[model samples]
Target: MSEASKHKAYAQRDGLNHVALVCDDLSSTEDRVPKYFEIYSHADYELGKRFYFHDDDGTEYEMVC
Candidate 1:
């Protein structure tokens, strides 16, 4: 198994609440993310929106605006 899969549940249990990567342009980032990752959820807040994704190994990530 991949290292990312090993920590999949751990990350969820710990409630990791930070952006893993920050991009200058979210639209550009969003366009490229699906090529490598699977987007599972998305939410729009007062400030902006967030896109949640996971890799093949089940590692999770969040992109926020």
Candidate 2:
């Protein structure tokens, strides 16, 4: 079976709060990282805007929030 076939979904649960992505350098990670990810949904915080990057990474991350 393929990678996708190996996994199965059942039900939906509560939404996610936040995620942390590993990077060689957080400073440049934002600028250097490719723009393959797009905003699926978002919210505003006291610090800044929170954007959700949609990809095959299995989870969403706050890239430029």
Most accurate candidate by TM-score: 1
7-43: candidate 2 lDDT, tens digit per residue: 2122122555446454444446555444666444444
Model 2 residue runs over 4 Å out of place are: 1-18, 21-34
- Residue 22, model 2: Cα distance from true site in angstroms: 12
Q: What is the C-alpha lDDT of each candidate?
A: 0.67, 0.46
Deviating ranges (above 4 Å) for candidate 1: 1-19
lDDT of 1 by residue, 23-61 (tens): 577788899898887776667878677777776755577
Top of the candidates by lDDT: 1
Q: What is the TM-score of each candidate against the true structure?
A: 0.59, 0.38
Model 1 pairs in collision = none
